[model samples]
Target chain A: MESTADSRVPVLNGRRARNKHDKHQRIFEAASALFTGQGYSSVTTQMVAERADVGTGTLFRYASSKAELLLMVMNEQMRLTTRLGVAESTDAASPNDAIMALLQPQIHLSLAFPENTAVYQREILFGTEQGRYRTEALARISELEDAVGNILARFAQTHRIRKDIDLNGAARTVFSTLHMELIRVSLGRQDPQTLTATLASHIDVLLLGILDPE
Target chain B: MESTADSRVPVLNGRRARNKHDKHQRIFEAASALFTGQGYSSVTTQMVAERADVGTGTLFRYASSKAELLLMVMNEQMRLTTRLGVAESTDAASPNDAIMALLQPQIHLSLAFPENTAVYQREILFGTEQGRYRTEALARISELEDAVGNILARFAQTHRIRKDIDLNGAARTVFSTLHMELIRVSLGRQDPQTLTATLASHIDVLLLGILDPE
Candidate 1:
């Protein structure tokens, strides 16, 4: 009797879950299309609702506002690419391998979704209102900084870098420099292969400057 | 007498010039105030015209659109700073000295009118419908890039950098790195001095990596 009840409950919940997911997917697709065509400034919640074929209240249920919607879209994109993991140097024989791995995904992301990347770029450079969205964006960036810092820390430890070096500051510098280089590449001013080679060379210089003598 | 006629003509023309100048100043002040308070999207031309105490037609004659008005304010600010000649580093005895001089004014400006800076950031990251304004922004950036490139070229020559090194790419990398760094500083995640020092160190690495071997 207990097994029969459990089976019935899941079947009912499964249909409802599928429907909910389909609706959420529609909302995201609508937001992406509208934002790309009209930009963040011109698009309205009502427009998003209409495009998604949902009521305004339903759209609100999924995303509190347009800013939150934008963040969700970006977060989803990041998650998708992150799962693939970065393939830096197949040889794994070089000390610079870890730094190259850390930078590869970032460069690829900027190249992949230039529009969404621009959206995140604007939000970080100039924050939104004091709302849930702004808080989440700030939190997300902090998490990213921490992740990059952890990677750098591991690299330093494995390579026996100088104990006196300010690892946190070095991490931020590396992260910022890589991010800036990617933005320049996205600006359509430089070829990708040249940018990759130049950045990799610069990273080598920076690491050598601060590292302990091996 | 002929002297009387000449005096009358000078007085009349001077009065007319003053009147036009006054109107232009009023319009610009009004637009700047509105943009600072409500951002670029919330303000309209009618509101600016009303605040300036000018007719709608008069405002249109001065600026064709809201974006143009914002760009005009930025142009005026650049002119004021240019007249100050903040770019000079005549007594600098080293390449780093000259680079520091170039970067100081940028940090000061980023902190000064942060709102205006925010507007321009958005405009560049995402293209606006105002084609002329966007074009002007690109033109100004290219001019500034040229100045930075020339300075780097001179430094490379003096310091004996490698003959085969791409100075153009190196210049772009330097400028682009600093540009994003300034934006990061504005976002309140970084301390100004730390950013400056770290960037200086990064420049050292770049110089060391690219310099020709003795």
Candidate 2:
């Protein structure tokens, strides 16, 4: 076994890697379909495996359990949201605009898949399996938070915000405010359009606190 | 009922009211002990009924389910925190001091019952039974936020903050920040003392946004 790689099994290794990637993609698609169709709690791992056309063992190798699988889907969605949000924020003309651009994609994602969004929020905060995936999920969110912080730091450079402002803390505050707004929307306390508009106003108030006075 | 009143059953009615009050107290104590001892999910309605010496139907009459019971305990704890916080804040020398004083009791409560606090946070945010108790919890929390807003408004009267500052929004923002801080503590990401200190700093930043410039 130790001599296999030394004997030049690169082709075999490459094929195995491709197969693993394909299986992972199939499992993700299957899990997403099942979860969206029947909700997160009702869908079983066996069902996902059957739908993905993979062995149960193969599915387990991809994700430790159903909750981990759910987190995997969330991780992918968050990655996409962060990528799109950063791209959207690139053309922002001011700090508030940049903040809004960064958050708009996430709001759209939440609105587009309200059920999944609810599950994501619940799982992140309180799922029993949270300990297993908390680091991974937090890493993804930290990336988004850092993006917001970067935008604020850029504003500080331009003298829009106070030169001595704590960009990281301010960004966390902004992200937390948006988070509360999302919870309100998910709980049906507010509509999505209102959440978006209200978020803009909240950011304006946040900016008023952080930005240099006119 | 009117016929009974006309028949003059005043002594019987008084005894019945006292019995009902005692039963409510006993139920609250039993539910609190069992939830804390075995955790929320593991403790069943039957178990609570047995501990409280009440019928299952009676427990249902008190709280519709285990989740609701958890919320009931949380509701009581929050009421205590609010009352204590308000009392402490009455001696606050400034708006910032008042805000900190208001949040300190809550932080102490969270630290005292870390497990219960986690369950409370989760249930309030995402429990299925939340719909039943959301109005009640929101009403209680609104009173707290309103208290914070009123303090801010009082400060405005003294020119401590800008007169036109959105006190309600500012209060909400402040509350959200403390909420995030609490979540961090419940997740074991931050120590209680650090949370208290950091929250003070966050409130200072919040003040910067609303306070009149020097």
lDDT of 1 at B22: 94
Candidate 2 chain B weakest ten by summed lDDT: B126-135
Off by over 4 Å in 1: A1-25, A29-47, A86-91, A95-97, A130-167, A177-195, A208-214, B1-23, B33-45, B54-67, B82-87, B128-137, B160-164, B192-195, B212-214
Per-residue CA lDDT of model 2 for A1-214, tens digit only, reads: 7877686745645878899889988999999888878777788888999999999998888888777888887777888988899899999898788888888888888877666777777666565554445558878778888988888777677666666567787788777777777777876767777776666756666666776666
User: What's each prediction's clash count?
Assistant: 0, 1
What does each candidate score in C-alpha RMSD? 7.0, 4.2
Model 2 CA RMSD to the hidden true structure, in angstroms: 4.2
Q: At residue B106, give the lDDT of candidate 2.
A: 81
Q: lDDT tens digits, residues B131-208, model 2?
A: 565558767778888998998778777766665556787788777777777887876767777777666766766766
Runs of candidate 2 exceeding 4 Å displacement: A1-23, A37-50, A53-62, A127-134, A160-165, A211-214, B1-26, B37-50, B53-61, B128-135, B160-165, B211-214
Give lDDT tens digits, candidate 1, residues A32-149: 8887676666789999999999999999888776777787666666654443333443334554665576456656877876555666666656665555555666665565566556
* Fraction of the reference Cα-Cα interface contacts (below 8 Å) that each candidate reproduces: 0.29, 0.52
Residue-level lDDT for B199 in candidate 1: 61
Model 2's TM-score against the true structure: 0.82
